[model samples]
Target: MNTIDEQLWDYIDGNLDAAQASIIKEKIDTDAEVKNQYEELLRFNLTFDKIELEEPSMSFTRNVMESVAIVPAPVAMKTQVDKKIIYSIGGFFIISLLALFGYVLYNSNLTMPGFDQKINFNFNLDKYITPTTVYSFLFADLVIGLIFLDRFLRDKIVQSKKI
Candidate 1:
């Protein structure tokens, strides 16, 4: 808006001090353009005053509040997990691994040859260790590593969120 329109608005809204109001009033009375603009602004102000603002229905706020209330609150990942269940699963895996190791050790030949005699270290591993077995072991290790990494990352994220 131009300075004249601003001044006229201030004049119409009675926002200007006596000196500014008097100056704008004189301009509006003397200048034809200022007078026309002032009349238009005055008509707009009157029309705005006469307008009745639309209001929401009485149930609008209640309906919105009810909908909001119906939604379940978010749960934290840590809280959703039970410590006892985690401990039991870890314990079961550890026990099974130890039992398997014990069985392997018990069945293996561990007799040591005399120190004076020549010890033959040659043993055929082709029967037990194939290419497929090596690949499967490596893949299992990779998967286990990835699972550990995922857990570590999730813990870090949860810790950061707390902060």
Candidate 2:
């Protein structure tokens, strides 16, 4: 019942559909409360329309704008690089690698220093596995985790600034 005024206000603002609006209009014409609300809204709207917005002083604008000093737009964390330059560098490296690989393949003749027969790779895990190696792997993972955390925090800070 109390919210009927809000609905009437919406109707006055033309936010209601044509059919609903017409119905509300009929209510405003026939119902005392609705008509009273409509009149009040009209008066308030007219008053609001007549009111003038205060303009900021020229010095205020000048001071604020001057304080805001011109800065270059924010760039991506991963700087934009020319794709052509990257591709050319990659192409050069790849071509060099391919040439070297081809040369090696063509010139290669396998010979062991002391082996009488061909060496077969029967890779035994027990021969290479050690406690220090496990600790080293754990340490490496921790450093990687720290780096990931730093990057994540930095990104979050940048995102917060954007918002």
Top candidate on lDDT is 1
lDDT score at residue 140, model 2, on the 0-100 scale: 100
Tens digits of per-residue lDDT, candidate 2, 1-163, equal 4678778778878899989888988998899987888898899988998999999886998788777767566776997799999999999999999999999988998665877687888999777778988899999999999999999999999999989
lDDT for every model?
A: 0.94, 0.88
lDDT accuracy of residue 52 in candidate 1: 100
Cα-based TM-score, every candidate: 0.42, 0.37
Minimal lDDT window, size 10, model 2: 67-76
All predictions: root-mean-square deviation over Cα?
Answer: 19.5, 22.9
Give candidate 1's whole-model lDDT. Answer: 0.94
Error of 1 at 85 (Å): 29
The regions of model 1 sitting more than 4 angstroms off are 70-163
Candidate 1 per-residue C-alpha lDDT over 79-103 given as tens digits, one digit per residue, 9 for 90 to 100: 4688899999999999999999999
